[model samples]
Each structure stands twice: as structure tokens, then as C-alpha cells.
Target: MRTIHAPRLLLLLGTSLVVRFGQTLRSEDRERGDVPGWVMITLMSATLVAFILVMAQGALESMFNAAMEKVNP
Candidate 1:
């Protein structure tokens, strides 16, 4: 429906613009600041979040494959 699609399109456009602006600001800030602690915390958090997501994805894929094999065979 138009109503559902219009909001989703607007949300996607808004998020893209915000992400671009934030990327520019982050690059500028990295050059201007020597906040080692803040950078380390951000990097550590990102690493942990990525690790969790990857593990979750692998587990889900395994479970789905097992289910599919059982169902098909």
C-alpha cells in the first residue's frame, strides 16, 4: 500500500542522510581529538556487538539447515 511504502521510503532516506552526516562528523572528530579512552571504548563495544551478531547468525543458520534436512529427508 502507498501509506506503508511512503513511510518506509522516507525512513530509509532520512536514515541514509543521517548516517552520511554522522560519518563526515566522525571523520572530522577523529582528526581533531586525542580521546584515546573514548575511541577504545567505542572500538571495544563495536567488536563485542559484531562478535555476538556473527555467533547468533551462525547458530541460526545451523538450526535452519538442520530443520530443512529433517523436513526434506
Candidate 2:
């Protein structure tokens, strides 16, 4: 059995997060109520922190292990 690595997985995950965040911002703009710049900034910052804490570390580790398995197997 093989496992994934770390750096490559983190880079991939970070890229995906940026893309998702962009989509979310676009969706927020389309909502009926207008979002003030400050509020939007605050929300985005908070969401980013939450994403980092909740997903980035663990997910990247798991992805790396999976990738390693594929490569070695």
C-alpha cells in the first residue's frame, strides 16, 4: 500500500479553494440584497480562515497519502 504526499496536495487544494471562493463571490453579488464592500471583505476573510482550519490541513494530508498509493501501486 502507498500514501499521498503533502506539498503537491496542499498546492492543489489551495488552488481549488481560490477558484471556489471566486465562484462564491460571484454568487454573492447576484443575490438580491447588496453586499457592502466591508461586509464582503469581512465575510471572505472569516470564511477563508474557517476553510483553512477545517479542510486544508487534514484534506491535504489525506490527498497526499492517496496519491502516494497510486504512484507506488
How accurate locally is residue 33 in candidate 2, as Cα lDDT from 0 to 100? 53
Q: Which consecutive 10 residues in model 2 have the weakest lDDT in total?
A: 32-41
lDDT of 1 by residue, 1-73 (tens): 4555544554555455556546656674666565654554565555555545555877889989999999995
CA displacement after TM-score superposition, residue 17 of candidate 1 (Å):
30
Candidate 1 residue pairs that clash:
none
Error of 2 at 67 (Å): 37
For candidate 2, the lDDT comes to 0.63
Give the winner by lDDT: 2
Per-residue lDDT of 18-64 in model 2, one digit per residue for the tens?
67656666774655454444455565566566557555778889999
Q: Can you give the lDDT of residue 14 in candidate 1?
A: 49
* TM per prediction: 0.34, 0.35
Model 1 clashes, total count: 0
